[model samples]
Target: MVKEALGFNILRAKVVTFKYQTVENMSVVKEKIIQEIESIQDEEMLNNIHHVLQNIYSKKSIIILNDEQKVKIAQAEKDYLEGRFYTTDTLFEEIING
Candidate 1:
């Protein structure tokens, strides 16, 4: 029933132990997602996705990414996890230099 109604092959309805009594919960979830999408739009998420796609399809763009790019991103994530991330000073400098 859910698959037919929602047209999503990747998702399934989680069996609820207690039934939702009102539309309020569903509406709140929808509104929250809308708000988050709006925030992402303002933060230029679309531009970043577009940039990634352009790079992916353009012959001039990298067809094969180097290990350095992968390592750099992984290290950044690791640093963030360890709470050892660079200050805005370093970030700004890197952005400016790049």
Candidate 2:
């Protein structure tokens, strides 16, 4: 029983640490975004960023995505940044029309 309790405590500590690390990672990303926004000078680029943020904030419901979906979205963004994504026109022409 004591060994079982010790195992439970270790699991709980791991969960707590995971949650803390998630929040810390988000805070780091938020700080980086703020720093980049402060350094941005182009009006059009800022406006585009503002529009995207507004769209994000305008969501009416709290949509809870599962871990797999989150991982897929992160991977998609990484692929996009690495120039491994398809263009809208190409997608429309090939997948949408064909």
Measured against the true structure, the TM-scores of the candidates, in listed sequence, are 0.25, 0.58
Once model 2 is optimally superposed onto the true structure by TM-score, how far is the C-alpha of residue 14 displaced, in angstroms? 0.6
lDDT of 2 by residue, 1-98 (tens): 99999999999999999999999999999999999999999997897787777778987644556689999999999999999988889998998679
State each model's C-alpha RMSD to the native: 18.1, 15.3
Output the lDDT of residue 25, model 1. Answer: 78
Enumerate residue pairs that collide in model 2.
none
- Please give, for residues 7-58, the per-residue lDDT of candidate 1 as tens digits: 5543333323123434667789889977866777445666665677788888
lDDT of each: 0.70, 0.89
To one decimal, what is the Cα RMSD in angstroms of model 2 from the true structure? 15.3
lDDT of 2: 0.89
Q: Which model scores highest in TM-score?
A: 2
